[model samples]
Target: MTIEPYQWAVRCPETEAKLAIRGLSKTFGTGAEAVHALVPLDLMVADGDFLCVVGPSGCGKTTLLNLVAGFETPSTGTVRLDGKDISGPGAERGVVFQQGALFNWMNVLENVAFGPRACGESKALAHRKALATLDMVGLKDFALKYPYQLSGGMQQRVGIARALTNDPQVLLMDEPFAALDQQTRETLLAEIRQLWQRTGKTILWITHSIEEALFLATHIVVMSPRPGRVRAAFRSRFNESKDPLITVAPDFVEAKRQIIHLLGQDANKEEV
Candidate 1:
């Protein structure tokens, strides 16, 4: 697929949006004690688009994600998936958390198969699906190994495989690679880019790393500090590049610089 260059404000047509956030806001508590975690914000994610969200700490990035995941109710407005309002969690969305969150007692295969089994698939069918998904993540050989037996990166891959076994339309990932070493994180970033291309799944990813966001996202949304809102949104093509050195390319560097500048402005405002 030929990705277009970055545009400062690229809007996905309403008809093409797989996930739509309209006037979504989240406030904790009531009255004077209320803490606005997210300000009313709108975003549209086109089908098969890899959208990464980045912002300062306490910027409500996770709050926005939770609303879409239907884990929390928005204080105002709604999140719609394929034109249907999201009332609560459903099978259509698969979430990968910061940690593996795998069942410690289950081996890799069992861990990955748990989702399918829960959805009423037969034990045999669930195992088959899990094995295939594990193979997709290059973990077929480690299927029998326990989570504690695997490295942190391998554990994360298992989490991803588990998420894919359900064949979800959208993948919601919250800093899935944040705990890994630099090298492992880079490798997984490349693998994830390939996985997204192959699966063509719409992804809503939350991250603190600007470079990771720039490299993995087809569209990047930078949010403002506290009561977070969209500070800037850009359509980027860097995710299309297969070259390992693409991150160091002049354009990629410049894009990173621009995002840094935007975050710097937020940082200054945060200090005041």
Candidate 2:
């Protein structure tokens, strides 16, 4: 794969931002029927930052992510990547949805390789990249298996692998582990952490689990109930620690409690 000069240039530590969302807001429909999904919100994502967004059910957490991924256009404001306006989806940003949207007709390797090949990589090179990525997600042995043959967690792994095959600078994950059992979710969490450390990719993750956000994010943002706006933003150091017992640490517990309290306050407002 030929890496463009700009792609290599972006990896420079001196670069200030990987993504910039300025007064971004989204609304669906028109007139009285208009449904405002996101209020004007501004955010800057530094290179290699793991940003996790959490909020109540209608708080537009996924809407925010979709904007960054260019899956939806913002009704107001702009989203820029490396200083350029993002008008549509590109290989620079890869996305992993809540469920693995794999093609049942294709085997695991083919599914993962589909992206690279679609991007014009030679079949052999794409297959090689796909296999390497499968190995990263710990699914190398299942390369030939079809989607139906794998469990839910395994399918999600393939979804992750497919996204990685593009070597995207940014990863937008929308509750990728939400469908899994607790055990499988925890396992995938560790793998995702390792992958982030290894690749240093910029990630925007949307999850409902505060514990999961604290465990994975370098930065966290909590949105208000609806017409979602950032109610709070925090920088967390817990994810940097290697201690297995860190989750039980007082600081971690306090942070989680604080976030839960914040969410609860907003939820109460919605009820009122």
Q: Which candidate is the best by TM-score?
A: 1
- 153-220: candidate 1 lDDT, tens digit per residue: 99999999999999999999999998999999999999999999899999999999999998999888
Q: Write the per-residue lDDT of candidate 2 for residues 1-272, one digit (tens) a residue.
A: 01011121243332467788888999999999999999898887888999899998988999998889888999999999998999999999999999999999999999999999999999999999999999998999999999999999999999999999999999999999998999999989988988999999999999999999889998888889889998988777777888787778887888898899989999888789
The candidate 1 region of ten consecutive residues with least summed lDDT is 1-10
lDDT score, residue 117, model 1?
96
Report the Cα lDDT for residue 9, model 2: 21
Off by over 4 Å in 1: 1-11
Models, CA RMSD each? 2.1, 6.3
Candidate 1 residue pairs that clash: none
lDDT of model 1 at residue 160?
Answer: 98
lDDT against true structure, model 2 = 0.89
Q: lDDT values of the candidates?
A: 0.90, 0.89
The per-residue C-alpha lDDT of model 2 at residue 117 equals 99
